[model samples]
Target chain A: MIEAIFEKFFQHYNFWAAVVIIFIGIYATIAKNNLFKKLLGLNIFQTGIFLFFISLGDIGSLETLGIGDATPPIIWKPAEERGYLYVNPLPHVLILTGIVVAAATTCVALALLIRIHKEYGTLEEDEIIELEAIRGD
Target chain B: MINTVVEQFPALIVTTGVFSAFTILILGLLSRKICYYIVLIVTAFHFILSIFTLQHVLTKGRIHYWFGGWRPPWGIEYVVDELNAYSLIVILFLGLLGIIFAKRSVEKEIEERKLPTFYTVMQLLISGCCGVVVTGDVFNLFVLAEVASLSTYALIAIAGGKALRASYNYLILGSIAICFYLLGIGFLYAVTGTLNMIDMRIILQNLYENKMVHVGFVLVLVGLGIKAAVFPLHTWQPDAYTYAPSAVTLIMSTVVAKTFVYALIRLIFSVFTVNFLELYINAWNLVPWLMGVAIIVASILAYRQNNIKRMLAYSSIVNVAYIVLGISFFNSQWSLSGALVNILNHAVAKGCAFAAVGAIVYKTGIKDVGALAGLANKMPYTSGALLISMLTLIGIPPSAGFVTKFYLAIGCLEMQNYLMLAIILLGTLLTLAYFLRVIEQLYFREGNSTQKEEVPFSMLAPTMFLAILCLAIGIFWLTGIPLEFLKKSITSMGVIFR
Candidate 1:
């Protein structure tokens, strides 16, 4: 059991890091009252997912202790030999789209924050709710 | 040559709208008058394209458009079967009507400088909905969902002041949902090594027992559930709907949520399939119970609301539950068609109701249920349309809501799920309990104003058109106009009970 735990800790450590980052991000988004911190938390959460996707493409040769065998996906030789040694390119392409999406979301989110601060002169969630309620129906 | 053009209609439908969005943006800097006209023409063309594709699908079958000339696994694809065509028709047609309604109403609510920007974002939202419905790639679907969602956050904020808070909460929640969806996609991609929907399905069939696939399924469901505003995840919806500009309210309440539900259904039926559920040890058996709770809880919440749009927002949760309930029983063809029909029925009913309420709010700035006392005397047509829509929501006969509810009841009976049937009956009662409060305020209560104030022709036209549609669909539902297409969509799912 101890050996299995050690194996999981050693082999899947990046995913464990991602899981930790995800927890922190969700906690900040849900538990934090400040709006800017929430947005930053969202970005951190997305970065965790990006890390997971990047790690999925990193299968290595048995000789290099799972770290250093796979080359960048660009082809140097023609047919059979080097093709199998290169890492998968699809996740990289998907991450490019993910980055663009994250950028767009952050821009819109910060813009809304500016507007909210302009209107209420505050950026805290509970305070905004208080203002809206005190203003009343 | 004709076959090729027909096959490419799915791609044209999305690109045209997106192309028109940029054009409107550029032309708005030069001239504002031409922008609305461009919007009308683009939506009309999109509606016509959807009709052509739906007809082509019903007769000639599904159309697949590959990006450039590349083949499936490597290239992104746009697929339009009966399911996609049906949703495309609803979205584009409503977008056309919403644009017409927005012309005058936006003039009342939005500043002149922002008009072009509003319409531009509106076009992008429509294009995003089209892209979400018709895409055959999961990652592509996520990108389009963001496009729709980001534009929506901006549109809601365009109202400014009070709307800014609503849009902020929506942004935070919506971003989290999108992240969950992306993580879900990553899990699926890691297991399957392909992003194409068909390719993923083939790969996932063998990986059904894998823990990653299970995690992927739950993540996707939770992500989309929040987007669809189902029950507990629906806290952002009421504020967003209430504070947005009326036209935004009408469109998002009907189109955006419905499109997310469509994407969820597509993921389940097309990518995951019932075989996945069987292999996953009937883990999805919880879905029906979840829908049952969403129906009961959301209806009760709708009952407690005093604000009209907020109440309607809660009711939208109930409508989403009906579709989920239908889809949960995917092994049964009857329930599946019932779910599909409910999509159209709820869209017409909810869209018309919101439009009429917008008309009333435009004429008199009242949104509370009690403040609408004697509103019927001043805005008879708008109030009447609201009455019809509310009746439809209550599932009264001769209304579109009744037809879908009838099918759902039948579906429940055929499944012999009496508890869910009881829940449905209780939900209809709850809908009646809430809507009657507004109806009484509309008709029975004394007038605050003496003079009659009719809504503008542009606004009244679309509201009445949808109200009349409520009647027509209920009367002709047995006539197989929507029934035939719904059946084709169901058969396309290839559900088998075993």
Candidate 2:
């Protein structure tokens, strides 16, 4: 039980870390007052997603079907004809593109935020919404 | 040497188009003014390459260009079949027309500095789209889809804050869709141990009842459905179209999004094959009946919209449902032809309509459909062209819309689908009701009493050219249609099973 607990703690560590980061991003996105902070939250949230993807793809180090055996992921023994499956390369492929997309979206969002600030003289979302209402565009 | 070149010809041509576009983009980044003309030249070269693929595909059985010469069920492949050839021609031609219109509209709407980068992004979008259609590997399809989408998000946001908001919303939803597709692809890849589409299909056919396969199919369909703007997942399209810069909106509405939908058609029909579709039908007549609902509902929704762009957006949804209906009644030659022709019919007619509306918006800054009074007097050629397109949208006689609608009705009838026929007819009337409302104001309204001013020739020329195309196509179809071979091609895709 102790080893299991220790291994669980060590294994999905990055996943949990990402989850925590995602929570912080969500909080910032919702509760923070600044527009740039909200954007920061969005960035943080996307970063968490990227981290989760990368971590998920590397979980082959701990095989679920191993059932507590200290076997490496190789067919070395005659009985061990099939070794454990390696980490999925697919998610890494997915996240690599996701990271690039996240960056592009961030650049465009920041540019729009800059334009919004220039036009309305305020960076707050509520203030901008009010300005839009007044101008009725 | 000849066999090697012949073996790799499809990939070479497809890549040539793709790389040339990328080269133009890079050059444009260094110098924007030069990029504008270069983009046109690059696209023209791509068109020539597409013609070569067309010739080869027509002569040969199918052009299968295995990636790095690695055989299928292992490495990626770029397959150019007759279906791909037809869709390639339509999509690239639309991109050509859209970019042509874009050259002038962009200069007016976008600032002086952003034009070159915008062209680069547009080229990237086309490359991504072409990659999606031609790739014989499923995983590569997803990657290409993202490449297209990433560039699209940037292109859409170039219109400024409202477009920015639209892009942000689009990014969120689009990401979810892509994630779902990747997860589905993961499932498929794990189960079959293959990424090549044809090999996977053969294997999947043997294991049709596998739970993972079912899950994968549903996920991929839903994912692609969102991209294709299927009835339920189409909320992002209108705002994205409306808030976008005129040039951006023109290309996106006319070409980019339509290419995605066409790719969805190939994935669903070609990959899944007819038996899988039959499985949906036997399981509570799912495909056909669901499509019947989509057609009726989407058309009614289109009839009710007030914003011009929103109306067109809803019309796109309604039109997409018609294509899905082809799947429901699978293997009907007429139905498939109707669905296939709708791709061109809608793109050409709507591309021109949006261009005309965009010109009107540039002149008056109006967004509401009711504001189109006496537009004929002010912008004669544009208004006249839009009027004709609206007629096409309404499926009036002697228009391309009529030709396609005729096939769809004939298709539904041949399959003994009366209820579907009734619904399509009803939708056609609803289409007429909305379009005629626009036409009535343009012609008979008293808003023309005042003096009218004309816009620049730059705006008028594109609309007039497309308007001529609309008339020429209708006349050509009347004078015995030249696309009989297209019918044979559709039949070859198991459309004649019934």
Candidate 3:
């Protein structure tokens, strides 16, 4: 049972790292009072997800039976005759798109923060809520 | 040549709106006056094209347009089946009315120089919604959803009061929701090795027992649940709707929320087939109970709201729960029809209500219910429209809201869930209680001001049109056009109905 547990651990080590990062990020987002930290937490959480996806696409070199040999995915020669395995490239592409989306979200959030600070003179969520309550009064 | 051109209409509808947004930007720099006309022409064209697309999908089969001639699992594609076409028509039709209503409301609310930019972003937002409904590629759906959401954030912040904070909260929470969506797609890709919705469905059938698939399902559910503002995740909605410009509130409450719900339905039914739910997972069994709780909770919260727009926003949560309730009972024809009918019924009724409120605010600048004492005496037409819409929202007979509740009650009966039936009836009473408070203030209580004229023709036209549609749709619902269409859509997605 211990050997099986170790095997499982070794197989999913990247996922375990991702889980830790996700929890840390979520905790920071929920528990932190600063808006900037919340944004950063979101970024960290996204980064962990990107890492998990990229790792899922990474397959090790397969040298047995003269198939899936380690080689770069270039079109220099016929793909079938090269007798080499190419790690799946789709996840990298998806993550690239994700990075762009993340960047756009951060840009918008930062702009909003700048606006909020200019208006409310505070960066903490609780402080802003208090200020809004005062204004309501 | 004509057939080829007709086949391209699905892609054209989205491109037209986006390209016109850019067109409005450049032309606005040249001359501000022409921008409105250009937006009008573009939205009108978009509406016409959407009607043609829906009619074509109904008459013929689905339209599958490959980007750059690439096939599935490789290149992006736009697929317009009956369901997408119906949603497209609804969205574009609302966009048309929203832009028209914005002419007067925007003039009243915004600075003169910012009008062109307002139209530009509005088009971009509409195009983003259109793209979300049309795209067959899941990644593309995420991209378009962000486009819609980011534009929404900008639009909400445009009002520049409490709007700044509201938009910021929405941005943070919305970003988290989109991130979860991306992660869910990543997990699905890991298990299925494909991103095309149809291809993913085929690949997922084999991976139904995989734990990753389950994780993906849960993540996507939570992610979209947040985006659709389902119950506990709906904290960002009330403030965003209350603080945004009235025209923007109209578009967001109607088109934006509807688009996310449509995407959720697509993900649940199209990407993950019903059989997958029955055989591999039982997570769906919890949906009806959750929605029932949401219906009760959201109504009670809405009942307590003093701000009119915020109250409507909370009530939107109630309508969304009803939709989810219908889809949860996926096996029943009544349940599915109830959900589908509510999409149209709720859209029209809510649009009328918000538009009328916008007009009232435009005329009197009041956003409170008690402050509207004797408003019916001054703005009779607008107030009358509000009354009809509020009754429709409260599910009174001879109104669209009633049809939704009737079908849903029958659905509850079909499922033999008498407890849910009682909850729904209780919800109706609560809806009446809140809306009647506003109605009584409008008609009964005395205002200290003299008589006044109604809102301008521009705003009144769309408000009255939608109010009348609310009544027409409810009274004519038994004619079965929407029912037959919804049944066809549900069946076309390969969901079997008993």
RMSD of 3: 2.4
Model 3 agreement with the true structure over B400-472: per-residue lDDT tens digits: 8988898889988998989989988988998998998999999999987757878889899999999999899
lDDT tens digits, residue span A90-116, model 3: 788888988898898889888888888
* Docking quality tier of model 2: acceptable
**DockQ score for model 3, please?**
0.69
Extract clashing residue pairs from model 1: none
Q: Give the lowest summed-lDDT range of ten residues in model 1 chain A.
A: A60-69
TM-score of 3: 0.95
> Which digits, one per residue and each the tens of the lDDT, describe model 2 over residues A85-111?
445565677677767766766776677
Pairwise lDDT winner, candidates 1 and 2: 1
The digit string of per-residue lDDT tens for model 1 on B99-136 reads 88888888889999998899999999999999999999
By DockQ, rank the candidates, best first.
Answer: 1, 3, 2
- Candidate 2: segments with Cα more than 4 A from true spot: A1-134, B1-26, B280-284, B448-455, B475-484, B491-498
A-chain TM-score of every model: 0.82, 0.71, 0.80
What candidate 1 gets wrong by more than 4 Å, as runs, is A1-4, A61-69, A73-83
